[model samples]
Target chain A: MFQQAKLHWTQSLHLELFQNSTKWHTLYEESYMDTSRPATQTATQAPPQAQLDIDKLVDEHYDYLFGYALRYFRSRDQVEDLVQETFLAVIEAVKSFEGNSSPRTWMIGILRNKIIDRLRLKCREAEGESIGFEQDLLSHLFDSVEHWISNVGPRVWGSCPEGALKQKQFFSTLEACLGKLPEKMRQIFLLRELDGYERDEICKTLKLSSSNVGVILHRSRLALQHCLQVNWFEEKKARGPQ
Target chain B: MISCQRATELISKRMEEPLSLKEELSLKLHLFICEFCEKFAQQVHLVRSAIKNGSTEPDDSDTHASAEAKERLKDKLKLRS
Candidate 1:
């Protein structure tokens, strides 16, 4: 119930991607249109044909950027604002773009940095697991020397349920399992696994040390696996000698 | 020999970053002797990969961008008309 609401609460809202009117405009015009730049001067540059189409760029990549930003922000306004900021940034920086990285890579890198800046300003709850969650919950899972307590060790999941990936129940179970995680750990897991963020990138974005990222990731993985065991996996027949 | 405890952390860490050679060797040895830990490592990898591209809850709303947001970005990009 609570989990279901959280899942739906994060729903992505989008209408059919019908191409809105495509206006043929140069970067000089569009870039200046948004700002106070005098509109008449066309800067000397490679032909517009050679330069990437600003309209095409936004049209093609908006959804990717939107979805990526959506991962970090639940607010529709926030997501669009970040995306708008990113598009503006991309155009403004396009002249300086070295063309070494692919356009998508460059744009995403910009978005990532923008998100971190937002994170810093927003001062969202401190990242990584809370000390209380650590001292109370995690300490109970391990001993003083960092060994799993008996009966708390990992268990056999036996055979994974067939066709589970095709089933909605599996994702619901996954969503519920994810909801049980500490906020920071859940974000770390989603960023690292689902969003495909590299460890150092995640560390920088969340403002955590690499090793701290490792710890949070390790614990998140453990909790997720354990959660799956109890909630979904262990229900199946076991093949191991009990 | 790494304890099952530390060995498990290394299991998850290896997913995000490369393990030191010594750490890697210890993990390989621990996983070799401990079937449960070995299975645990594999299962973790399975879940990560599934979440990456294979797993999908198509019914979820946020997976796709809102059309209004798209229009707004186009407008902000100065897609005049």
Candidate 2:
């Protein structure tokens, strides 16, 4: 009789948690609906005259799209698949293009949504393994007493360049470092940094605790700063005269 | 004095939300004396700015799509069109 009561309480607890999560999912989806609904609704029967020149579009934008997709997917085939999906989405949604933005910008907007949808699915699938990645990285950087190790501590990076992001070499090196991050860490980092999602919003969207998001973001920044210092700054010094 | 690890964590945390007065004061005190942590704080700001500016779009000079992938996509679109 006692076991039965305990089981009933646990079941009700799960139900409450499930209901709260569903509430989060609905709230997340509602935000997407505002931006994504219109183009998708009209996508089914795009006017024939609205047909985009697929060949031209591919020739012009394929590189940019491919490079962008590589940020999320490592394998060339997987990246190709994402780019293909983006173009297909563009073809379907072209009629709804309001000419308010350039074609490149519009396609980027579509591809961004597609990437987010894929990430949302991935987040659910990898829920268990989310936060513990690169715990060793933190320890390796610091010590048992929560102090940075002597040999592994940060170096002075000098001044940041005036137009650092505009430089292709620096940006590519940054992308490579980002690619080196653990998958879940990279996801949360990008969602916060690149996509500009708020902390609470990220907690809801990825179904992580607020503290977990904070830890992941903190570790990711540490790792990334180290990577940039090594790959970009030190390497530049090595190649140049003092 | 807080350890550098704790100081760095607070430094990153401050980016997400305003730190408590105690946290802010401790972190500020730590950064003031520790050259490495000070450099680290600057790098964090630099990296955050770089990510914000760079990653949203593909750079023109970055890697481009292969011909085969483009051809394959074009062929697939042909069937749909």
Candidate 3:
């Protein structure tokens, strides 16, 4: 009888949680609809053609920039701000955009300098209290990442079981996985993989060597694979048996 | 056996683009012979696909900056322009 009662209570709690999640999903969808068009209008004021160019540019590149900034700032609030700043800088500097590289490449080049500038300012404000050398910083960054990846485990991958539902879940998991990566590795991965920059361009833009970029990307991928396999996939398998 | 080290390098390149015919054949031949390497390859492929289809979409909120921030940045750029 106690077991039955306990089961009832637990089921009720899950139902409540499900209802709340549905409510939140509705709220999120509405918020997206309410804000998206206006945001686009005010964000880029280029003419129709230029607007199209900017739209394509943003669609293709924004995630990479957002992810890149998120790694450095380690905060979502600042991610959008940094991305907006990056775009505004790109727009203002568009006249000087020589088309020497892909738009994504050029924007990321701008973003790298912006990030370095921000970091230097941060270091200055901290007043040489020892933010540590670049190598040390990178090591610390990866150490935390390796730790997180070990904890998060593997991810689930398959055909989307419930259409958009699966896609959203996958994306949410992907974002969380990205958050777990070390700052520099995350930056390099997003810049190279997500943004479609050539390795040479990534190395030049980030002032990293080709070898360094390769090492960072390899580690990032391994960590991501491990996180997915352990966290999402194995857990799903366990649940499936029950 | 494809060492994890070599597999790591090839995995990076594969994500960017499929391996060349010769390289692809070599990788497949290795996978046919090595269960662990095959699993590793499948996992790498899964990660690549996930990222490819993933939401690199900009957040909808960033469509517009705060008016005040926009003006400030514009003025600053104008000075340089």
Per-candidate iRMSD: 4.9, 4.9, 8.7
Q: Which ten residues in a row have the lowest lDDT in candidate 2 chain A?
A: A16-25
C-alpha TM-scores of all predictions: 0.62, 0.76, 0.51
Q: Candidate 3 residues A177-233, lDDT tens each?
A: 777776656666765665445777677755657776676677777667666566666
Best by lDDT: 2
Kindly list the per-residue Cα lDDT of model 1 for residues B1-81, writing each as its tens digit: 888778888898788778999999999999999876886797787677557644332346655777876776666666432
Report the C-alpha lDDT of model 2 over A5-41, residue by residue, as the tens digit: 2233333332221121111112121212233355435
Off by over 4 Å in 2: A1-51, A124-133, A159-169, A240-242, B55-64
True contacts recovered per prediction: 0.57, 0.75, 0.17
What stretches of model 3 exceed 4 Å from their correct place?
Answer: A1-68, A76-81, A87-166, B16-26, B57-81
Sorting all predicted structures by TM-score, with the top scorer first, yields: 2, 1, 3
Clash count, one per candidate:
8, 0, 12
| Candidate number with the higher DockQ (1 or 2) | 2
Better of 1 and 2 by lDDT: 2
lDDT of 1 at B76: 62
**Every model's TM-score on chain B:** 0.67, 0.80, 0.47
lDDT of 1 at B14: 84
lDDT value, residue B8 of candidate 2: 90
Worst 10 residues of 1 chain B by lDDT: B53-62
**Which candidate model has the greater DockQ, 2 or 3?**
2
